[model samples]
Target: MKYLTIFSLLAFITLFSSSCDNDFNINDDWADITVVYGLLDPAADTNWIRVQRAYLGEAAASASYGEPDSVYYDTTAISVYLEAYSRGADGSLGTPVNTIFLKPDFTSRKLDDGIYSTDDFRLYRTTETIEEDKTYKLVVEKSNAKHPEASSITEIVGIQQSSNSGFRFVLPNPNVIAARTFNGNLKWYQSDQAEIYEVDVYFYYKEVNRQTGAVEHLVQKLDYTTIEGAQIPADPFETIDVDGSPNNIYTLLASNLPELKPNTLRFFKSFTVIIWAGGEDLAKYIDLNRPTEGVNNSKPEFPDIENGTGLFSSRTSIMLDEVAMSQQMATTYYLSSTLCEKGFAIVTSGDTCYCERIPGIGPERVCD
Candidate 1:
C-alpha cells in the first residue's frame, strides 16, 4: 500500500528541474520523463506502483496540472512489470525466477482532491506474493519506443517467519513487573535488507464516569525509539537493543494524558508494540532528501529509477498486541501514590478500588 501525494510529485519535479538547469524555466524542450514511486512489502497481499509522466510545456506547469493528460498516461500507453531474481553466492543476480505483469488500477484506491486531476487516478498493481529473499526489479515500458524504459531494483525488507528473522519483543515480557525503577533493554532481531527501524508503544485503558456509570475506552501512543542507518551484521539473526525504562512510560503518560476528572475512574487495560523496518535503499533516499539548513539548502537527488525520477524501495511493519505487565507491577504503578492521584484503579475478584478526592481533603480509596 505505497502511494504518493501530489506534493511529493511536485517536489520530484523541482528536484529534477534544479538538476537540469541553473535557472527555473517553464518552457523547456519537451522531454519524456517518467515518474515512479513504489515500495515493496513482503507482508502485503497486493503491491502497487504509481506511474506518471512529468510535463514541461510553454504554458505554466500549474495551469496544466489539473488536466489528466498532463500528469497521467493512458491505460494502454504503458506496461508495468516486476522481475524476480535470486542472488548468487557471489552476490550477483541469478537467473530470472518469474515476471509479474502489473495491471492498471483505476478504482481500487481513491486519491484526495487536489490540483491534480482525479477523474482517472491510476496505479499499477499485482496480487503475487513478494518473496523476502529475492531481488525485485520494476520496469515501466512506454508504447512509444522513443522513450527509454524506466527500471529500478530493490531487495525486500525481510521480517517474515520463513526468513527466520521475525520480529519479537524481548524485554518487558508479558509477565514482567514493570516497576517505576525498572530499567531494561527493549530488543528485537534485525531483518535482512533493513537499515532503519522505528518502534511505537500504545497504552490502552478504560475510563468510567462515576456519576453516569458510562465507560469509555481510550488509548495513547508513544514514539518509543528509532534506530537509523544500522549496519547489517554478517549474521542475519543479530539482535538490536534500545533503552527501555518504565519511568519513561510513566513520564510520557503524565505529560500527554489529560488529568482525571473528579468523577472518573480509569483502569489499565494493556499495551501494544509496533515496529517498522525500512530497506537500505529507502533509508538512503530518506537521508539524501532530508532538508538541509543554513546557507546550504540544496539537497542531493535520490531518484533510483534509471531514466526516470522518484523512489522504488521496500518497507514492512509488525505489531505485537495484548502485551501485559505482571499484576504486582500493574498495581504498583497504576495505583501508586503518584499515578493514583489521576483517578487510577484496579479490578480484582469482581471488586474495584479507585482513588477519590473530597473537597478540602486529600485522596482516599473507595471500593465497590
Candidate 2:
C-alpha cells in the first residue's frame, strides 16, 4: 500500500508540473502586418526609392495567422511612422529632426493584411532657413500589435543652392524705389504649356538704415505657375516694360521710398534668383505614390539662376517627385541669362542712367 501511495504521489507531482508549463495564453489570428515605404529626392533621379519592410506581432501570438482552436487576438491595432534627418558623425542614423507623418486625412491608419501602401515621397522645407548647402536623411517605421519592427534608410537628400548670381547688382541709384530693383523681362517655353509667369527675381537681403543704423530685411518667395492668375501673362509683361505679369517690378521703383546712401546701404547681398515655381511646375518632382494637394503637397520646383541647372537648364525637365520626372519644352536657354546675371537698370528712354528716381509726388507728400 505504501508503494502504491508513493507512485500516486509521483503522478500527482507530474500532473502539477504539466499544468504549470501551460502558463502561456493561446492567441488566435495573430499575424505580421504589412507596410511599404519609399523616398523621393529632387537631386537624385527624382523618384521614390522603396526602403524596406516591417512586421508587428505580439509575443503571446508568436504563431502565424490562421491557427486552429487558438485564442482570439484581443488587440486589433497598427501604426506607421517615417523619420527624416541629417546624418551624424557616428553614421548609425542621427537624431530624427524631420519626419513625415503619412496617415490619410481623418482616416484610421491601420496596416492590416500586411498590405501597407505609401509613397514616402517628400520635398524638404526648412522651418529655419535651410542653408545653401546641407544634407538630410529620411527614415520610415511601421508597427502593429503582432509585428513591431523597423527598416533602414538607404536614401539621403541634400539641399543645394539653386543658383549663383555671380554678381547680383541692385539698382545703385539711391533714389530708385526698392521694388524697381526686381523688375526684369521674363520669357519661357514649355511643352505641357508655354506661357510667362512672374518675371520677378526673388532674393533674400538684409537692409540697414543709412541714417538710423538699424538693420532691416526684405524677403519674398512663392512657388510660381503660368497656369493663369498666378502671374501676369507675357502680353502684360510688355505693358510693365520690365516684361512680366507681376508689374510689381516697375512698382518697386515707385513703391515706398527708403532713405538713400549710394555706397552705404546694401541690396541683395546673398541674392539668389528665387524662381517662384508654382505647384503646377513643382508637381514634376513629387512622389505621386502618395496623394498631395493645395498647401499639404510638395511645392513645385521653380526656375532660378543656378548655373548649368538653373531655371533655364531645368526649364524643360522639372523635378516632379522621386518617382516621376519631366523635360522642358526646349533645353535651349530661353530666359536672358545676361539679364539675370546683371542687376536691373531702369531705362527711361532718354535718361542715360539705368533708371530714374522720380521724386514722390503722391498726394500724401504735397505739403509746403
Each prediction's whole-model lDDT (CA): 0.79, 0.32
Off by over 4 Å in 2: 1-39, 44-182, 188-201, 222-246, 250-271, 275-368
> Quick one: best lDDT, which candidate?
1
Clashing pairs in 1: none
lDDT of 2 by residue, 186-243 (tens): 3332221212223233344455554587776665443332333334334421221223
TM-score, every prediction:
0.78, 0.25
Cα displacement (Å) at residue 260, model 1? 6.3
TM-score (C-alpha, index-matched) for candidate 1: 0.78
